[model samples]
Target: MPRERVIFLVDVQSFFASIEKTADRSLQHKPIVVAGDPERRSGVILAACPLAKQWGIETAEALWEAQQKCPGVTVVKPHMQKYIEISVQLTAIMESFSDLVEPYSIDEQFIDLTPTLHLFGGSPYQAARLLQHKIQQEIGVYARIGIGPNKVLAKMACDNFAKKNKEGIAHISYDTLPATLWPLPVRSLFGVGSRMSRHLERMGIRTIGQLAQTPVERLRKKWGINGERLWLTANGIDESPVSPRSHDEQKAIGHHMTLPRDYETLEQIKVILLELSEEVGRRARRKGYVGDTVSVGVRGARFDLPTGFHRQTKLTEKTNDGLDVFKAAFDLFCTHWDGEPIRSAGVALSGLEPDHCRQLSLFNFETTLKKERLSKAVDHIKNKYGAAAILRAASLTAAGQARDRAQKIGGHYK
Candidate 1:
């Protein structure tokens, strides 16, 4: 027998900006925006409040463009710690509702109410309302939740309908699936990114209904396993479990930075790569793993043309040393680079393995040992005092952004 699932997806609206308003009461009624890179007023807007959004201001736009849209829109720096603290509080609230709560991200979650609805007077709607009201009163952030027979429907309902509704909630099931889900664009389905959407578009599959009705054999012939999977998703037939363990999977560890300005010289570009290498090495060392491959990507500064270069090389041995990562990235850049102005640069270490085993070469053993010692000492100093407590001479130069980046989390205000 198939049991009906009761899944609810909760999304906090403009999370960062809402937290800014809640922390500072005066900003609640104003046009609030949370942005990064305070040194550049033209820096990216991470979040925008409802009022600012009304004026066509949006997240990811330049702050200067936002000000132009809503003239004098209030700008605030992002507080990652404060947001994380509040997310933890929200998690606690969801756990109170049901033991099957799964946190999807910083501002999203899924709660299964199938087994726990009896405790809430046998009404999932009532439980949902209670959670919404309590969060507003306690946390002062508005949340919209979508209810469905499974996770996929719940997510789509929340994104397509619930967030825009007056009640901030929507419920979907077998009876309502056809009218609600079938009419949406095929591209609107989850897991369908830009590339997939264009491929489906070329095949004349424009809407979910068309996709669901297409023959299984035809879809399989077109996309192999992925095509069949898309067909199942379109039909609202998902058998996958909502496992929380998925978050633990780390395939690659890397960091990328959009420069304050373009880098036209090789010396300037390599300096940025070294800074990124340090952070990547620190992260890998913290996790006690080393990568078998190193990759580098450089994005062009010219927005109109929008071109870049990428290269990856296999390492003779896995490494977590800062200097090794830098050298690998530098060699890639030297080999593949065309000397174009670079707007961003990134370094990644992948094909991870535990550091417990060792395979050493007699020739390079001494040099490798020295680099490892230096990396550990630098990591210790930064962890104890601060990331900016010590800096390489190259980072102190005009080309380096390590000082400004040290205080940031994922290239945004900390």
Candidate 2:
């Protein structure tokens, strides 16, 4: 039998919010909001569960406003390390179902479930429900799955499931398109943002059915090439594949940590920068990759503060040595920061290529070899003991704090 292609769009339900609930059983049924403190300039809500939505709370809203809407809303701090750890495990679980899993983000993925559907008794719904139950049981989080003929409709169905129902799985086939997809608002389409929605409204196009039938010329005149793509997606005509173990567009490998409290001393922030650089370098070497551009991001007390800064500098050599990354970050900090209190910091590397294939000057070959040997030795010791087994004096002060934060997520390298 010729197998029919089926795209599965899987999304973690209220990811950050759900993680908080998992950690504390008391938080499971109550309305929860995940965000930074409103007192600081970083008081932005990042994620909220459906329970919070009932009280008019939403992601990206001001924390203060969200509190006003839902006075009993419990606020939880962001623990990205823990979230990423869970994400890594979740990704592995998805890959176990089939090799054709594409990570859409930290909390979402698309899987090609076409060939394997028959193994689960020739029913897409049965496979989807089974997957959903497995994820919920293993990860302690709810995930809604959407199964469709293509990726776009599957994604749309996922979004629709999140907003309208909690069936744990939603299916959208061509036969049920009119009943399931036609009444959806055009704004519900993936590419439709605020400005795009206004443009669509102005054209008197208000529904997915209308968009599917709108003249291509009129759409192209308004949105150019993007308009044509949207039209196809609205009509469930997306042809993109769900590639499982595909090549990634990785320009760099980096890791960053945000502090629970701000530091007023330059010495404190410098120590943090070095730790972050070490993390980024370690990941780079693990993947046998190196990059020439190193970037630093610093968050101040508030958005209006001039101290909030981001700076990137090119490295003198293509390397993943911790010292090289630290040098770049130090240069960046010296130029952009003025010893203002630092709330958070992150480091990244870009302009990446395979380490073995990277171009290197003949004169620096010996120096590079020495650095690589030293890095390997350090990694061996840390891998055997812990990340804090051997740390430079510069990062000693911030080591304890960093470990404590990463512990919340049970740190896993992806």
- For residues 285-391, write the lDDT of model 1, one tens digit per residue: 98888888999999999989877988899989899887788999999999988878999999999988766776767899899888888888998999998899898
For model 2, the run of ten residues with the poorest summed lDDT: 405-414
Q: Model 1, residue 128: what's the lDDT?
A: 83
Candidate 2: clashing residue pairs, number: 2
lDDT measured at residue 31 in model 1 versus the true structure, 0 to 100: 92
The 0-to-1 C-alpha lDDT of every candidate, in the order given, reads: 0.87, 0.81
lDDT (Cα) of model 1: 0.87
Superposing every Cα of model 1 onto the true structure, what RMSD results? 4.2
Per-residue C-alpha lDDT of model 2 across residues 172-274, encoded as one tens digit per residue: 8877877888788888888888888778888888888888889988888877899999888878887788876454768667776667777777778778888
Model 2 TM-score relative to the real fold: 0.80
lDDT of 2 at 356: 79
**Candidate 1 residue pairs in backbone clash:** none
Number of clashing pairs per prediction, in order: 0, 2
Task: Determine which window of 10 residues in candidate 1 has minimal summed lDDT.
Answer: 240-249
